[model samples]
Target: MADNILRIAIQKSGRLSEDSLKLIKECGIRFDNGAGKLKTNATNFPAEILFLRDDDIPGYVEDGVAHLGIVGENVSEESARDVDTVHKLGFSRCRLSIGVLREHDYQGVSDLQGKSIATTYPRLLGQYLEANGVNAAIHEISGSVEIAPSIGLADAVCDIVSSGSTLLSNGLKEVETIFRSEAVMIASKHLSDTQKTLLDQLLFRIKSVQAAKN
Candidate 1:
């Protein structure tokens, strides 16, 4: 590893990981990921890849552990870490939404009052509920939030809905969308001059690829 290498953090797995690597390849960068390595050196670029959780990417970037990161807007917002959105990757599109059992007599947002809502994104969900004047009890669950209602853990659940299959399988219906999100490129506040130059180059390539999609 070089002393001044630009480390870019990306999701180790899940929807954003594939596209993140694909975009790097399309941009003419080559990296080798043989097995379960945490960090991989790019063969054709002046950057190193750090495979990390999407939710933790923003914090890594903000703390200067990573020079840049690829993460979903939802995770970035939910993390509330100090970082800059360099580009919207236009992939892994989803919405943070409030959901309840299909049989629940959900009329509108008002029906959520005094209800227990389970969610991974408590901060964002809380903000949305507060703005809507709904006094819902938020139950913070790390994952499987959709199952909360069915298991009697909560009256409803707030979570990210992509194709809505998870909600459908769990017998939940989306009632309110708190935020629309997609994967994005994020940068830390601190960067050396050489790293900044490299970042600019990477951003240019990303922009070119993004434009080609449109």
Candidate 2:
């Protein structure tokens, strides 16, 4: 909570977690991350790292509980928090897609009219549906969205698609991509002058690391 130190939130465990940690180390920020530790202080940089649920990262940054966060763009937009997406990490790339039963005569998004779609991302799904002028019922569920169709829980599903293997295994076929997502750095709007300067330095290092890969 010090004005001079930046508090960066990241997913504790998920596809983005390792990439986030690697980026920080690449930025020359050293810290002891003991196993199961929820938080750690950077030994070289004026920052602290808070490991949290990916879905909660944006809200923590928006509330200034953490000065910054790295999360998927899908989660950020779905959370609808008032945090600034300062940079795109360009990793943990995936898409939010709509899928239907493989046996169904799937034609297009228009075929979803009046049908119920299960998803963890109701907001994003709703937006995509509205933009396409398609009307459907959105059933928000916490997890196991892909199995919705099999159990008769819903007619279709809106979920994250990485390699499309999961969908195929679940007897569903991806029909439409609603959102493309990758890891992104988000900053709190209430950063102090000192914190902002430190963030700039950290970003400089990150960019340098990224440049070296080319």
Candidate 3:
């Protein structure tokens, strides 16, 4: 491993991982991620890969644990982590939304007053509710927020809705969208001169690859 190598954080599993590796390969950056490994060293470039949860990427970058990261914009914004969004990856598009039972007569945002809402993104949800002057209760769940309404944990759920299958399966209807999101590349505030040079090269390759796709 190079002493001045750059470290890039990426999701270990789920939707974005395969595409992230594919983009790296398309950019001629060769690296091997052995199964069940938390970190991998790139062979063709001075870079290391750190596998982690997508939600944790922002913090990793902000803390300088990883020099850069690929993460969803929603997670990054929700975390309120101090980092720079270098580029948009144009994948994993979704919406942060307020969802409720299909039968509920939710005419407007004001209707949620005093109601309990379950969400993974409590900070974002709380900000939205407060802005709308809706004094709803926000229940913070790590995951499976969609089931909160069905199981009576909350009257509604503020969560990511993609394809609407999960919400449909859970018998919830999206009432309002809090934010639109997609995958983005982020970098830490502090970078050594060599690290910055390498990152610029990587970003150039990424931009070329992204442009080719468009």
Candidate 1 Cα deviation (angstroms), residue 189: 0.3
Candidate 3, TM-score vs. the true structure? 0.96
- Positional deviation of residue 12's Cα in model 1 after best superposition, in angstroms: 0.5
Estimate the lDDT of model 2. Answer: 0.95
Q: Which residue segments of model 3 deviate by more than 4 Å?
A: 1-3
Query: Model 1, 66-183: lDDT tens per residue?
Result: 9999999999999999999988888999999989999988899999889899889999999998899989898998987889988899999999999999999999999888899999
Please write out the lDDT profile of model 2 over residues 1-214, one tens digit for every residue: 5799999999999989999999999888899999999999999888899999999999999999999999999999999999999898989999999999999998888999999999999999999999999999999999989999999999999999998898999999999999999999999999999999988998888889889998
Better of 2 and 3 by TM-score: 2
TM for candidate 1 is 0.97
Clashes of each: 0, 0, 0
lDDT of 3 by residue, 183-212 (tens): 899998977889899989998998998888
Model 2 lowest lDDT segment of ten: 201-210
Instruction: Specify the highest-TM-score model's number.
Output: 2
What are the TM-scores, per candidate, against the unseen true structure? Answer: 0.97, 0.99, 0.96
Off by over 4 Å in 1: 1-3
